[model samples]
Target chain A: MAREGNVVNLVENFKTSIVMPTAQSFPAKTVPVMESDAVATSKRPIIRIDGVTKTYRNGTNALEKIDLDINAGEFVSLVGPSGCGKSTLLRLIAGLGTASAGEIDWPTSTYDAKGHPMPDLGFVFQEPTLMPWRTVFDNVYLPLKLGGVKRKDAHDRVTEALEMTGLARFAAAYPRQLSGGMKMRVSIARALVKRPKILLMDEPFAALDEITRTKLNNDLLHLWEQQGWTVVFVTHSIYESVYLSSRIVVMTGRPGRLSDDIEIDAAYPRNEAFRTSSDYGEYCTRVSAALHSASAAGDGEH
Target chain B: MSVIATEPRRLRLLPLHFMRSETAGRWLHAVVPITFVLFLVVVWEIAVRELGVSKVILPAPSVIGEALAQNWPVLLRSLAITFSVMIEAFLLAVLSGIGMSVIFARFRILEMAVFPLAVILQVTPMIAIAPLLLIWVGLDHVDRALLILATVVAFFPILSNTTLGLRSVDHNLRDLFLLNRATSWQRLVELELPSSLPYILGGMKISGGLALIGSVVAEFVAGSGSATGLAWRIVEAANDLDTPRMFAALFLLSGLGVFNFAALTALQHLLLRTWHESAIRTER
Candidate 1:
């Protein structure tokens, strides 16, 4: 029923964007709808990226004419080489920075009095970014606390988030007392406690060991399935993107632009078995080739 | 203990590592320094007696002790006066310095306008300024002059350290606060103040010692005109050629300085033991 309301909001957003003065610059065919879900609902994308470009203060063009849309409940990965401005795009989506040109529209989200969309969203950075001074429970409770929930009221939700991250036992422990993996779990719990509609992660498990990263990947998939939230993940790993994403968007550097879009076409509840499957290897190879050609495209343009 | 005692040779061989236990290390820290000081005192007493050193030049430790006992009441009263002045100066410095740093952090322009003058005051020797302060405040307000001098001496470290601390918030944490839509006041209280605590405590430790030194310097400058503080007692005893009394007063002043430092250190440990890298035990 809520999904029906989202469809209505999407139409309204589409109308507004089309009426915008700069809408003529956007290509007509760039509206992204997931292949599997397109036939099922014809539901509009939750977030629309239309003709977006970002240039830094020193005249470096970080990203150029980015046009993509993220459908609700989709797991999308933005994979690119280093300095490719994928992180910049993720930050722009998170509203951490302003777009130099064009706009990102979050159609289904509510706006504050300032006309900026209020964050019903969570962002997990490459670093764990937990407060060293706060205990695990208190760190997780921070979002609720900032949102005007008293500590006593937030206690249960805070505990639930910790339990989800398998960190219930360490709720009383300080960040310094926890191992690297445990600290990252605390960071995840903090991001999840608010139960946001969108979860934007930028290489969240990149610093962990392969075994820990794999375990976290499984855990994240479990949470995403249960939570039913849209995840736009950013990573440098092709295998990670293939194993996790419903669709992969490949980007190239030197004024980053999207060069390839491929659907993984694999069933979820992915495990260690799926990781070792031949199907996984084929997808990894396909994504790797896409990345290779994208870099080549970047070179040819220069 | 019995096993080590039975093997005396083993005890000698393992002597260095014997204080590995935390309680044993703590005991050594307290007992060893006192024993060394006592040993020095005993050596001094014997040397002065053997060399027939003039009592006027270097009083024996026993004679200084005797002088301390005889003038205990007067010394205690003088100590009380000095204690009050030092406490008032330290408290004033703490409140004003922290308050000023917070203001400076909020208004960088004000910090720029005032910081150079602060540096000028800090670099200029307090001794040279004490007499002028005495004249400006007038000799009748000698206690006020003493407090102003001490506060000026102790104020700079707290102001500078706290200002640095207030600005040293983690950039990622700052972003988190922004994302949370934290009001400016909430950010200051919940984030900035707690983050600055260790630096503030460190500055307070240095400022605590300086407060005592400033009080003494002020008293010395005030001279016989204000004869209530220990420094004034020292000056008076020196004028009368009472070397033992002077040594006794010096002893009390040093004792007070040590007490002030130890108290501040304990407070720092209490506040930061669980969180700060400086205060936490690395082992666990």
Candidate 2:
């Protein structure tokens, strides 16, 4: 339900950062200090993008002539060194930033040439961008509030979102009070509250210690399975890219472009066993080589 | 039980971060000056009789005290009247200042257009403007309120600080609201206003003192001469050379200033107690 079966975006000449602030600044993934439900990801592309390109201001060709499709229920991670237009592609799909000259048409039971993706998107920022003044519950409920959902109906959904992220106990807490991983949970909960068909995430867990990051990766796949929403996750870490993603879209540096799309041949509800498997190590090695080749290609572009 | 030791105090410090506060100790130490007043009063009594200085030159502390006690009701009545004027002036400054700040925060063109005007109002001398306002608005209740000593001292801080607070919100948080598709009005109410609370409260705190001072200044000029606020009492005490009575009135005025400062501080704490750091401190 989640995986889009075909790949599209093959960007070129993206004037991106090898160490753009966005890479480090993306919100660190945090497991809420609560219960954990290990669900797996769905399979199928609910979102489709054909021939999408983004050129940022200042003559930075962030993404060039890219095309990709995402299924309704799948965990797809965009992996790159840095300044690879992976995040840009995610942002374009989220409708946060506009694409320079391509169609981002969504299948809303309608698709015109001029049509863009669904204007209503659930975007989890890299910085756990929770409002400081509101409680975790209020922050999560914010999307519903904007949609004009009454508080009574919004409350239950907000609770469920929190519970899914294992943050129900801390619903009344503020963002500043939470640990790094917990804050990310609230960010995830807020995104989930919208029930968006497509969830765009930008390295949402790069700040955490290794142990916490792996836990969140596992928990995320579980939730992806249960909810069946298309997820576009951006990551710079090779280990994380391999652990959770059904499809790892490897990108290269400066004029960030996608270099490889390696599909994980493993089965659903992938557990601790997958990470230690020999196949996983092989997959990691292949993706590592792909990343270096793309980086070398990017150097050639310069 | 293990206890965390306090960090050793540094000898030299960054001037801005350094605090010379001994709030509790200072309050306790106030006893010295208070008792000094008593000792001085006694010494004055002895010196006056010994030197044979007449009552007209400088009345004895005893004489001033007697006069204040004897005329207590009259001084109390005048204090009440002064307080009444102060309240009216303070309320008007607060209401209009906050109203205008909200306007400027929402409308950029209006801010650009009117902000200079506000700065002008802040720098303009109140004493110079009070007479004109008195003439135009008349000496009636509305006029009295209109010519209130509020513009420079009170209203400006309220306006400037409030505008500063509204503009000080974090960029990412602002983007969050935009992503949520919040309407402009919703952004103002849900995001801008709440974010601006500390600055607004701080402005209100500063403005509170300004408003009180303004009322007294206005009362001094337009206060029907013999029938004004604490200003009139000061004048009446001066006519009779009653220093204690003058001090008593002066005390009430200073007390009003203290009261305004504390009231705003309390209101700030009440509203922001849960979320804000500045409001919950033991000493500000």
Candidate 3:
């Protein structure tokens, strides 16, 4: 029931449930219907990008007429060459910059009970970006403190996020004392403390060694499964995208446009066994072919 | 009974062993400099006595010490006056310098418009204008004239250092703060001020010495009839050819400068030991 993505049908059902007085009269009939409706609403696409284009001040066309939909609970990866605008598109989605042509809509703006617009999304940049002066716990407490949550109330959530990132012991340690992988974990814990519905990561593990990268990749997948939040990741690594994403969007070179959109039919909780399987190899080959053709097309345009 | 007796004896020797190994190097580092100064003073005392130098020409260290003890009441009163003037001037310079730097951080136009004027004030010699200040404020209010002169000499370093510090915020951290939608007031208090603390303290170390020097120079210009600062005492002793008294006053002045520098260093260490690289003492 939580896998349903049609919000229109859910709204219609919600209207009928409100109109029919007998629906509430029977407690048995109302419970399942209401639960399904809530699941459907949660599963709907939270953001829609329609015909968006971005051109910088120096007349470089970074992205041209890009359109995409990001639904809740789906893990999406944007993969492309170096000059492609995957990072630019992520910044646009983050509202850090505006698109030149079209509109990007947040269809479902989640609000708290107090009617304050909760920051329902978190962003991780290429670097860990932790303040060197603060400890891991204080860095994780920043977003909540900015939102006016008292320190006493924010303590539990901060501890939970640190534990999820496997950094519970390092909460009091400064960022300078941490290794690259540990600093990145502190960044992840900072993002997760807000309990955001969507997590946007931009090459978060690009600076780590291959062994550490693989370990963090597995840890991130486990956290995503346990939390059941939507993830939109940006990376240039073909193997990483194939291993982590449920759906991959390959983009064109320089003036980046959508080139290919492929889906992997693999099962969830993918571990080392699946990584060595024939099916994973096949998916990787297919995506590599798509990337090759996309780059070739980009060469022809110039 | 034997175990308890040996335990107390062993514990008493623990500090001696620890100092011999771990803290011995630090103690040596301090002792070497003091030992060198004492050696130099002994050489001077011997040279003066053996060469049969006139007492009026160059007083030995013992004679200077004796002079300091004999005129303790008058010298102490004069030292108090000079020390008070230095403190007042330093406080005024710090408050106004930090207040102006904040203004400059908030408004680029004001900084551009008035920064050159600050540079001009700094480059112009305080000694050249001390007489002018005395005339304007009058001889009766010599302390106030000295205050203005010292403040002028001590204000520039803090303004420049703090301005650089405020602009030195990490680019990535600034972007993160903006992404979180922090208010300007929050940015200044939480980010800018703490980031600028080491720089401000560094500037204070320099200005601390300059304030004392300015007080002494201004007192020289104020002259000796009514002013009772150490500088005036040096001038009166020079005229009377009392070389020992002159050396005594100079000793106190140098001691005050060293004390000021040591105090500021301690403050910097106390505040920045947790995070600043300069203050942290790594084993390696």
lDDT of each: 0.85, 0.73, 0.83
Pairs of residues clashing in candidate 3: none
Off by over 4 Å in 2: A1-45, A50-61, A108-120, A299-302, B1-74, B138-148, B221-227, B279-284
Cα RMSD, each candidate: 7.7, 10.0, 10.1
Q: Give the poorly placed runs of model 1, Cα more than 4 Å off.
A: A1-43, A297-302, B1-9, B13-18
CA lDDT, candidate 3, residue A76: 89
Write model 3 residue lDDT over A195-265, tens digit each, in one string.
98889999999999999999999999998999998899999888899899988888889788888777766
What's the DockQ of model 2? 0.41
Off by over 4 Å in 3: A1-43, A110-118, A292-302, B1-21, B224-226
Candidate 1 clash pair list: none
True A-B contacts kept by model 1: 0.38
Supply DockQ values for each candidate.
0.51, 0.41, 0.32
Question: Model 2: what TM-score?
Answer: 0.77
Best of the candidates, lDDT: 1
Error of 3 at A271 (Å): 1.8
Tens digit of lDDT per residue, candidate 2, span B106-135? 779999999999888778888788877777
Error of 3 at A182 (Å): 1.3
